[model samples]
Target: MTLSPSETARYRRHLTLPELGPAGQERLKCARVLVVGSGGLGSPASLYLAAAGIGTLGIVDGDRVEPSNLHRQVLFETVDIGRLKAEAARERLLAINPEITVVAHAFTLRASNARELIERYDIVLDGTDRLSTRYLVNDACVLLRKPLITAAIHRFEGQAMSYVPGRGPCYRCLFPQAVEAVGESCADAGVLGVLPGVLGLIQATEAIKLATGIGEPLIGRLLTYDALSLRFAELPVSRRRECPVCAEHPRITALEDTAEACAADAPLSVRRLSATALRRLLVEARRSGPGLVLIDVREPWEFDAGHLEGARNIPLGELRGRLDDLAGEGPPIFVCRSGRRSLTACAIALQAGMAAPAHLEGGLLEWVAAIDPRLRLVAG
Candidate 1:
């Protein structure tokens, strides 16, 4: 894999690095990597991989770019709204480095085509948000014996792990069973805009190391990152002997769609108050002398970041025990970063004998999206 004269000049910085000289640069030029998502994490991971001269790169996503995605999904621009993520990301990557091959897989990954799609690449980077799709990618990568760099983000936190076939445990080895859709995901639990960029770059670094055979990859350990605290910790992970996915006598022989692959949380049944409607109510109540009580279920730190005025900071962890304190507080409208915790809060309210429970429809994220971010935001 000889580098072209132009490529040599383009990767001068990489060539100068002792760890990744011309030989490593050539390996990168010949490596083929597949990034399974084009959102937050995948955006930075794929962008750097492309810029670093990965020979062939694939972007797989069926979602279209929306204004909401622009904050974290840096691959797409304002004009790219409504365009397929993979398509938009492919264009961006090519524009970054036309010297490499960029392939856009503008469809969701499913059981039927997971294996075939993964087989074409030397390494797999799974940054998908769905549990089902994450498991599917993990299983397919294990079956194909391709090294995988997988990472995920939650509100202000993220974790990454690598699986090199016989060297370390697969994603299943860490969590053998997929959970039925329970609780809110990051989509429902809002995340800081910059969190994924940190973990995504870790994925890119791991992929580069795996591609060029330098530096120890994040195998046999789960690397965790806390954005708020600016800290990183590692947890040791070992393969399970009775594990179904990657064990001595594995039960997961084929990539059949299991509960793990079909996992999603059950839909919630609760009264949702739209941000617009809530805003109107707040305005009316302000003029009429505090008619509505807003209960914020986010953590203290999140509440401190920004919250609706007149909201009470009752973190979800303390909501259940403090149910009796709201005896004379009137009907409360719960809120959180995303609507999930608020829904949970509503359920708790119902069980505590409240006839009805209501929450901000999209949480604070939705409010910010619909209204002014800086307006009416104050610490509880």
Candidate 2:
């Protein structure tokens, strides 16, 4: 297809680029790219691709725009909060490039539907934060022979890579095992807002370059960014012949949740102790022999307010680092406000092979309700 009369103005900058003249511009117009996650990376990637006149832009996101997203999710506004991210991104993107077709899927990408959705696109852009989703996207793209431009952001750091069909190493080849959940999400650890924007733009650049075959792709290379130092590093990657999906041996023939598989490998640290047994232990700790070390694994902010009188304080995120402090050869009764953190801490302690520590069956809330109904706990 020839450039439209209006296209000359819309993509004049692209036409001037030696690598992306009229011919390359036409290829972009004929290309279809599916971008996963309409947050941060998705927002910028979708906007730039649409602006560049990509023929069709497909967006898949299950989350909604939140007030917190306004900082970096450039495609959304305060008014768009609560609206599905995919729908909101489509509306904003079309407004930028009405010439392109913008299709929005307000649903999560799961194993069952991944193949069908990925098969429809020429390339897939992975902007998801979750590892499971990333593996799903990579596997589906490989099975369908679609190139994948992947990016991930954590705190002030970010990584980007490109996966070309039968050429470069897939994500699994680089990260053979799922990493333990370190509890440092953008929400918990906080982000600079501009980090995702930078990473997303880079992801978009990879997509554009790959589509036009302009520059050497990031295939088999991992680019690490340090927003704090304003420096970037590129690491070499090699394809694994033993990779379950991409390897020659190919142990994994069908689709599986890579992220979940990783998570399952190092499952949550907390396990349940029978309520009856816990109640009996609580009596034992209060009355006689070996005193139970009641530990509160909540944030200090939560601990200062009120906690069990004799409880030790160690936030769950930092628990793994402080395991040595708890290796006193006695059972510790871990407690948290709702039991979630405490349960998690107990799991960590147990995994460290600490003699199965106990959780205050119902946590601090239950401890107050049952053990000391009249205790004045500090309010958060």
Candidate 3:
């Protein structure tokens, strides 16, 4: 991982630093990073990562540049509008640093190829706009145990976070469900244009920190920026014990084709109900059943085995369609095996404009332990 003469001169500024001297420069030369999407956020992120001398930089984008993209996507010029984004970004990044190897993955990241694509790299920088693709990258990284630096933009504001395998929370731990275009798209909402540049820079910084093993990465904290107010905020996050993909008994053990991401990304919002309190609510609801509904979001067999008395079955996958059934039925309470799927259900309900939706905290396992152990239900 020794640096050549050209690399030495190229990264002269980095080499002069105390912490990131020759050793850090060499680590950057040895690092392999995949930058997913070369659009708004990916644009500045890829540029800096290349400028910083990431040894093998890969760009994954399946989009064609357009005239509108020129204003924000710094990787493309007017002449490159018709070109593929991955190829275009590869050329731009390489032109910036020919000393580094650039790999172009000119295809969409899908369930079929996510693992293989992500497995090839030491770290992943996800600056994708599509919510589904974002989740796909997150799950694949968590499964592969690779470090992922992810960011998102909405209007004049942006956010960034990092996920290091077996160390901190995954994106799903922060946002456990894929919400549809509930007012999330930049095309529809309009972006400040320069907003993503800030977040993308943050993504690049985190990747370099992770690669060079230097500055503390945003592993368990979410970094947010507000353009109008010029404020940067950090929110501490913790891994959910019932997280669908990273938990003890993950309900979503496999990757499936998520629907086309027409929805915009939303903030994390879910209410939790303790087992002891829910039992009282169930008793109260039995007399006046219209104000509240208990939803069991699990497999039919799991529900049939044992669930809270008076709970209705509506598995998490089908929770979207069943949302309408509960219309005017009052704000519902969702339950699942280990509280994972139920949290997803709560998020879905909130996205659908329903009243505040809540999940049984810790799921039925908590109910069994805290209230009724004789219920004969086991944690899956």
lDDT of 2 by residue, 1-380 (tens): 78887987889998998889999999999899999998877888888889989999999999998898888889998999999999989999999988889999889999988988888899899988666887788788877779999988766777788999889888777654445453434466566788988889898899888889898999987786779778785555668767767887776667776544222222222333433556677677789877667778888877887766667888877988988887765877777765545655665665576654666545566657666665445543
TM-score of each: 0.69, 0.69, 0.73
lDDT of each: 0.83, 0.77, 0.83
Query: Candidate 1 residues 168-201, lDDT tens each?
Result: 8888776665555345544667779898899899
Looking at model 3, report the run of 10 residues with the lowest lDDT sum. Answer: 262-271
With candidate 2 superimposed using the best TM-score fit, by how many Å does residue 43's alpha carbon deviate from the native? 1.0
Candidate ranking under lDDT, highest first, comes to 3, 1, 2
Off by over 4 Å in 1: 258-380
TM-score of 3: 0.73
Error of 3 at 122 (Å): 0.6
C-alpha lDDT (0 to 100) for residue 306 of candidate 3: 86
Per-residue error for 346 in candidate 2, Å, reads 24
In lDDT terms, which candidate is top?
3
Best by TM-score: 3
